[model samples]
Target: MPADRDVLLSARDLHKAYQLGRVDVSVLRGASLEVGRGEFLAVMGRSGSGKSTLLHVIGALDPPDRGSVTLDGQDVFRMPPRGRERIRNRDIGFVFQFYHLLPELNLLENVLVPGMVGRSLTAWVRQRRGLRRKAIELLEKLGLEHRLQHRPRELSGGERQRVAIARALLNEPRLLLADEPTGNLDRASGKAILDHLVELNDGGQTIVMVTHDADVAALAHRCVHLKEGQVTSRHDPRDAERPVQSVSRR
Candidate 1:
């Protein structure tokens, strides 16, 4: 860890729960963490270990019942509705296990959705050409240029995942949150996706990935486990009891 390491995201004492029928299931219990700029960190745990819940809270998609999440020093949950939405759109990118692509839209059109967001009809029209160019370049980078006109239903699982990655990157967000990006694909396709993530991280993109596979977690610069709602480093016994784990690139 560098002395000058910049912390881009901070979650302090986070707590979240869900009501399942008559039961209240607590997922995150005082979980906290810090992610540095230009770092690729992986959160690992067992099934239903609240890894996805942690990502959702970090990305500002779900608000925690207790504690605060700050991105770039701004408290996300404390912001206004529009402010939080802006951060989600412009500062964060998300890639899910299911590659949530629009089945009705082509690859290019789907990638353009982020750019079209928060823009008026006239504004979108003025920016469409440039946004289209960027989207194509992203598709080309992801090896999906030839499938630009292809719909999600027509493409293979890997191809759809690539397209979804391109869409998440359309806005050039500062943070990329991936939840089980390789869980649905075979080993080869999953390796390809992880390779892309490694390349992106090498280029200084910050990423927080959640996975249960230790092999997948090994690809990141650092790995932290979510146990009892708190992040702990298996490599460091001291971190096992700490509530807040500030992980930095090794």
Candidate 2:
């Protein structure tokens, strides 16, 4: 893993466009990005800047209009639909602004959903016991061990989000994609969640997150700024001061 850790994900000239009444509305226009293994990357942009679209494209949930996305050196778009789904199930985990937990299922059951996608109950139960154990461990790490038996309605927003994070990590994925993960929470809860993400990164989990908040973006090692469907700037906060000098020259 360490030998191949230099590049976990790479995107080149990525483009995504949608049709709206005979017009092609481009969402991602020649965006390029690379994420090293165990690196935490933040993407920031205003609404309509295509940040979320880029995340979805990278995750294989949506295909780009053009360009290539490679994960672990395999071309993501070259795969068939079923192949793509399989890759998503086996290697990618996703979190969103809304905790998309099932209302009727308890936390353990909810966390097991991804593993249950194409299996019988007995098989799922048998195969996913280890996953369940990992989920419990993740929840314990996120301070949600006591809430495992609770339903989504019974938990607060932050608790539900924590559960969602635990669910995302259940598969031990290499890439964790979060789209505005803290958009619905208060500042303190958001901060805590950000810290949790940082902890995961510190433990060698690769993450790509889309955040509208600059403070949250600052937590990542690098920030890719998007505008007009293109990646306009990339800021490494460690060298953030250099940009100030460049701007002053202008």
Candidate 3:
């Protein structure tokens, strides 16, 4: 973490485990991390390294067996279920490897799901226009305007992922959490998604991504590697002097 940057999210001494049949498999052990505001941080590791678990913990999707997470000075685990849900809906947006767009909903409607989650029928009716406009704008920004009415099954892998990204940005979340966002795409498609993420980060959207690909991780400002549930190394792709303009192909 940089000394001059403001910390937007922090986790300390995190520990988690799961019960698999009759055995307990420990995942995270004393993991700690701090994400600065407007910073693009990448978490990288091999399969079963607990990278996904770490992201879920910080994003409040799953609770850690022990340790604490603070987001923008508020204790996340300490909040009630409703409060945590609010924070998840209002402050954080998530993108995953699999585009989880609803099969029955069109791209635009899927993007609007988060906004409609807790609203009453009357409230939704009143706010529908504005929300629809925002969703359209986001889809356009992601180059998916023409596909707004198309269902997920009608789109390609890359296009569906782009739609997922658009949906994540619809709420103008303070933080974006992406887990293996390009794992399901080809090299070119993956590069395009990473480029979009870079553009968003340059425009002041904070992001934390988990990826196994080193090439993808290079796009981030800083990256931390995990091994056997513990942070093993941290590095800046720019070598600590100045930031690089873009990721290099290798």
Candidate 4:
């Protein structure tokens, strides 16, 4: 969280649990965080620290067992089912490590998925042209202009990840939540992805990225460590401001 900017996202005393067979697994226990407007923050933790679960709850993808998540000024959990779905579609953008692109769809079509969701056929027809232009611009900006007609299977790992990012930005979301965005990429590819993320943050796109690697997390403006189901540390690495990621290969 940046100290001088307005708060854009806030999670207060969050608690989330999962029922695994007969066992009750508590994932988040009173975890709280705040992100300033246009801030890029990273959450770093080991496996099973519930970083992904926290992102889902805040992004309206999953409901928390207790507590609340507020985006801008609206309470996320208090919204109706349709409203929350709308939030997921229009308010928050998600970039996953796996690059969840539909294999059958081409790059151009894949980027347009968010705009087509929750729209009537008539509405889609009316808005498709503008959305198409926006998608083209995003893809081109991400250096995918030549691959617009290509399917996911035809692209490289970095190229596929770029398509995922373009799709996430199609709706012009208020918050972008990335889960292990560089986890599956090679060192060079991972650094390239981080560079794009840095460029987005510079353009005032508020982002919350989750990663286990400290070097990858250092790319953010501020880093928080989630330990034992809660955020227990906060630091800003003013030294490593460049997009150089020295992540270890797993």
Candidate 5:
């Protein structure tokens, strides 16, 4: 809702399906949305609602069967693999329901993994150091500064999830995609993670979070509900639906 922010990500009539054996399982049935810079938006849905599939499509990890996804005005699926890799590496950050940290690496090393893939050692070192600093800062913010050297196996569930958040922040991405970020945490820890996400949003991070928690969705400036692979409703929940305008595609 900030007046000065720019639209950062947009999806138009996105559809995704999987062919299993002889049958087609349609997941995302024409879901469209626009996310602006410095905005916090949440997608709420139950299990099998296709919210995570929609996030994966939007993140460019998987392509949609139909429609288009544009990030910062660039068509995601239209780009070459190398180009998409560059964008996925440098422009977008992802957080998952499961803490996907590598058990072999420590927190700092895990956070710097993205830097190791596409850049030269010199260039990597330059960004790596800066990103490392940011990672440490994020860990401190998440109350995990003491666990910097711990491996994923050594940390608690909440601590591991905090490391995932730090890893996602390593790229200073233009857009952050969180798929059920707090789904694995306890009630109090989930609230803590949500609070940290809100703090990041306050610091001008553009976040698109997929959550089933109504309280978590309420933290966002806007909330969109998805059911049966389509957006069913969108509103502020606290305000009249007339004032809470939203776009529905498909």
Candidate 6:
């Protein structure tokens, strides 16, 4: 941990398991981590290593059986259901391997989904213009300005993933959680998506990404490896004689 950076998210003694018939499979055992503000951290592990589970626990999407997750100084697991949902919606943004855009909605409409949550149709109608502008701004920033009216089925795989990224940024979240975000794309497409994420991180959007690809992990400020549900090693790329890029103002 750097002395100058503030810890934005922290997890301690996380443990999770599942029942399979008469057997219990433990996915995480005393896993702990700290992510600083504006940092890009990569969690890498083999299949069934509980990498995704850790991300879910920290992002408030799922709870750990025994552990504590603090986000921006708030104990996430201690919050009520509604409070947890609020944190998940307004503070943390998630991007998954599969582009989960609604097939029935256009790109712009899908991007507006987060903003419309918990709002009545009448209330949404009242604020629709501002929400639409925000969505348009996000899509434009993601290079999907011309495809705002296009449905998910009409776009290429890379384009669809871009739309998903735009949707994740619709709320200007404090932290972005990505689970194998480029798992479904080809090498070229994956690199493109990662480049976009790197750019975002450079601009002070904190990101925690889970990836199996070593090349992708190299782009992050730090990489932590997990094995059999425990953090095995932590590596800082800047310590390997690589120049550290200055983070830009958001």
Q: Which residue ranges in model 1 land beyond 4 Å of their true spot?
A: 1-5, 235-250
Candidate 1 global lDDT: 0.88
Which residue runs does candidate 6 get wrong by more than 4 Å? Answer: 120-123, 234-250
TM-score-better candidate, 4 vs 6: 4
Candidate 5 C-alpha error for residue 222, in Å = 0.7
| TM-scores of all candidate predictions against the true structure | 0.92, 0.89, 0.92, 0.92, 0.89, 0.90
Q: What lDDT does the true structure give each of the candidates? A: 0.88, 0.83, 0.86, 0.88, 0.82, 0.85
Residue runs of model 5 more than 4 Å from their true location after superposition: 1-5, 235-250
Please report, as a residue range, the 10-residue window in candidate 6 with the lowest summed lDDT. Answer: 241-250
Q: Give the TM-score of candidate 2.
A: 0.89
lDDT of candidate 1 over 1-250, digit per residue (tens): 3123499999999999999999999999998888899889988887888999999999999999999999888999998999999999989999999998888999999999999887779989998999999999999999998988888999989888999899999989999999999999999999999999999999999999998776777778888889878887664433233332334334
| Model 6 vs. true fold: TM | 0.90
Candidate 6 achieves a global lDDT of 0.85
Top of the candidates by lDDT:
1
- For candidate 2, write residues 16-79 as lDDT tens digits: 8989999999888899888889888888887777888999999988889899999999898998
| Candidate 5, 157-230: lDDT as tens digits | 87888888888887788998999899999988888888888889888999999987776676788888777677
Native-to-model Cα distance after best TM-score fit, residue 85 in candidate 5, in Å: 0.6
Clashes of each: 0, 0, 0, 0, 0, 0
Candidate 3 vs 5: which has more TM-score: 3
Model 4 over residues 1-250: C-alpha lDDT tens digits? 4463498888989998899999999999999999899888888877788989999998989888898898878898897888888889998999998999999999999999999997789989999999999999999999999999999999989999999999999999999999999999999999989999999998999999999877888678777877767885543343234432532221
Write candidate 3's Cα lDDT for 108-137 as tens digits. 999999889767799889999999999999
Cα lDDT, model 1, residue 209: 95
